[model samples]
Target chain A: MEEIKEQTGHMPRIGEPAPAFEAVTTHGTLKLEDFKGSWLILFSHPADFTPVCTTEFIAFTEIHPKLQKRGVELLGLSVDSVSSHIAWVRNVEEKMGVKIPFPIIADLNKEVSLAYGMIHPGQSKTETVRCVFIIDPNQKIRTILYYPLTTGRNMDEILRIIDALQTTDKHGVATPANWRPGDEVVVPPPNTQEMAEERLKQGYKCVDWYLCKKKL
Target chain B: MACISPDGKPTESGTKMLRALQAGLKSPEEIAKETGLPLFRVRSGLRELTQAGLADQKEDKYKLSEKGTKLIK
Candidate 1:
């Protein structure tokens, strides 16, 4: 069972512009302007050097090539020291053979965590829960995902969602459950009788008037 | 594939980069070019940095998210 608590501080939502920030990273000082015209996948974990977070970070990097091809960026966050990020990156690369390709925010002070609503005091003190934000090139908060401390997020699902979002925006269609690229898409429901009549005759994989699937 | 901190924001280590951010440094394109990684990757990285109680982004850029220069230690 999950315990819910009152939200605090600049909570993000789908379709909302994401809160902005400037932070030091392994590479250098990073600003939001850097991401203009690109998609971003921002995520947070409780801490560095932990077993679960370590595995997830490695997995995210594993799909870096694929994500990049899609024009998406990946960043990780936790209230750990830069030293911890370095050690964890080394451990993941050395033992697992996958290098962490992105910077991990050393939010040692928790200011950034609170701003993004990543810190859930009800869940735990002195750490953040698993929170993921899918931001678009416009800096809009396109999607949000929160996971419990016990669960590790699925990278495949994430990439799938990105594919779905980009596809929908590009093609003017929606995604159905378990949707994948090259699969059929769902046509938005027609609001008028005229569209319904034309919908059936249109060249789409229409299971019915309101539902259709198409290749991405 | 080591990214080699493409932006040259001057982080001695990943953690130190974050610390310097907490203190302040906000440039996105520099981060991308310096990292040799994708621009989106840098944006996502900055977001994560802020969400984890460490950094912040503003006016389309990011700086150390810590509320102030006040280090707990």
Candidate 2:
């Protein structure tokens, strides 16, 4: 397919290195390495001055503090020029009563969008669709989220997911359904018969012998 | 335990959503038609995907989250 042909480069994958980027941001020229030693949430919107994008941008800006406390940095991108990003950021601050302290890439060339697979043909040809990538401090891709044009994302869910991912990575466990920070985690099923027998003796909450539960 | 298909497809509802997504039915109506799931189920299933941040909802369409995209691929 022509679409497939257009995406020939080796795209970034979870557990793989996130492609490095150096571009002019709202403040000045910035590089991906500048965010070293912290988690990065790289997301994209279609364009500026749009209603839906504005609401999402405002929400992300508001949640930046919470994201920062957990060692996450926020970077937003769109196919808009530097001037456009500045204007929109100013407007968002003035009209929405929030400041976007993060660097928004002025990706007019569509380089970052393409590398991140943010552009989808069905969504819009010229503008990037909603895409969110959670890149870890080691520069490995941790998680990715793609959204349609109509619905808005829940910021709390994003926060919770990062919390879950951080905890899962730390403890080698899986968070259960409706998992919140400080809640019990779902223990991984014992992989062997011997281990299964010993696991039940631990007195973890279990729906069955192999299904153990413990708080994170 | 739900087993993945020999062809690497996910379990029943997972496979249904995958098939629908591949067919470009990221909307409720399209998913129902392709998977024979009720509209409510399709919506709720998609909601589950979104709630866990596995799906992104924007404007009026649905698409797999970047993480969901990788999982399906």
Candidate 3:
């Protein structure tokens, strides 16, 4: 595992600049900088023509417009050739009749996948594990989620995270468990004692100064 | 039809941006301020709106194209 880690370089953490790359995508050759001004969800599947990945693609497509309305773009990746990616996307569209409206990276060389630490040696040396990287508009890695090979991802959870991250950035607050849009958001705790005393009188739904929820 | 039936309609943000452009908001900052949207969102929306041929950009400013003007109620 350490050897694989050394080979893949360090796995990117939250708050790091996304590792840069230029690679062949279904849309065309694309670079990481191409998506700089937009919020991006760069995800990696194990392979193309797989059942779980297919369902995920359809689900992702289902949310594409919703994400677009919120200023987000989707990019998929795998250690497959451009032809394979193209064929599979077309097959899904023809067979399942679901249009995949995003560019997918064909990482046949695995340079992009390894750089993003998408490949898990323990899971499968040849394939990337299910991984999701939610990058902000500033190109900062905001959130990362990894699912096992067998399990598919939830579209609702994906949308929820984007909402949570965007809300936190816009309103300077954190989300509580199972947060949805229009729900009360948790306010940041006051640092100074003076502010803490004033926090109670501020009319938030407060159990204590450290724990307060407010409507945005 | 698919689950998402996008019948060539502009999204809410896209519509707000088109409306902003029609109201003579030129720069992304101005549009963002007018529509109460995030500056980044305004910038991104301008790119998409331009790509969709509903808006045009000259220098740093944007204006609604004829197609965009037709969509505004």
Candidate 4:
């Protein structure tokens, strides 16, 4: 585990500030700071015009409105040119009738891909594997998900992350396993012995002092 | 073939460009200037509108298609 950790140490970890980058996208010249005020999902696929990526793009489009409602913006990246991205998006709209509303970065130079560690040498030397970076409004990397080139990502889990993050931030509570909105939340454990003893008498449902559950 | 999907809705930029076309704005630059959208946005919106069969490009100018006209009406 230590060897694996050392090998992947260059990749940004959760709670770290996301690496800043600026590049031309289908929307325009956009920078990481451009999305600083809103939650951003910065994801990368292997390449354009591929099968799994196509389905993923369509799925992302279907969830774009939901993400926007939660104040999250989506940005995609690949080591393809802007023209290729445009053609591929247009092709998707034309062929599949699904419009991609978000901008995709044309990281032809692979600068942004390299910075985000999207390129897995074991996966492919030239193309980026599927990687998703969930960044918070404060420009912090909140979560990172990596999928192999053959697999697509789960849209529900992506939305759930945003919901979980927002709910926890607002209520100062942690989510339990498989916790969806409205499910009971895990309460922060008490530090003092008196508080621990009193925790049981409090209104929360406690499996133990350290494992109390509450609804916010 | 229908340009937009059955469940498709017009995006904000798409609507603005459609309104600009309705107002006789032709070129993308003219549409951008009229709509107060960025040039890049206008370009992309035009592409989407054209693909969605909401706008027609003639020479360097764009005008609303019949479907787009009905939409605005």
> Which candidate has the highest DockQ of all?
1
Model 4 RMSD in Å is 9.8
Better of 1 and 3 by TM-score: 3
Candidate 2, residues A129-214, lDDT tens digits: the string is 78889988888899988898777778998999899999988999998889999899989899898989888888899888767899
Segments in model 2 whose C-alpha atoms lie over 4 Å from true places = A7-11, B1-73
Compose the digit string of candidate 4's lDDT tens values, residues A95-201: 99999988899999888887888888788878889999999989999999999999999999999999999998999999988999989999989999999999999
TM-score of 1: 0.73
Determine which window of 10 residues in candidate 1 chain B has minimal summed lDDT: B1-10
Full ranking by DockQ: 1, 4, 3, 2
**What is the C-alpha lDDT profile of model 1 across A31-106, one tens digit per residue?**
6566678898889998877889988987898888899899898878888887778888898788888888887777
CA lDDT scores, all candidates in order? 0.73, 0.77, 0.85, 0.85
Question: Between prediction 2 and prediction 4, which has the larger TM-score?
Answer: 4
Residue A208 CA displacement from its true place in model 3, Å: 1.0
- Angstrom error of the Cα, residue B37, model 1: value is 5.2
Which scores higher on DockQ, 2 or 4? 4
The DockQ-based CAPRI class assigned to model 1 is: incorrect
lDDT by residue (B1-73, candidate 3, tens digit) is: 0101157577676778788888763987788789886564466567667777888999989998888788776
Query: What's model 3's TM-score?
Result: 0.75
Give lDDT: candidate 2, residue A153: 76
Better of 1 and 4 by TM-score: 4
Of the true interface contacts, each candidate retains a share of 0.24, 0.00, 0.00, 0.05
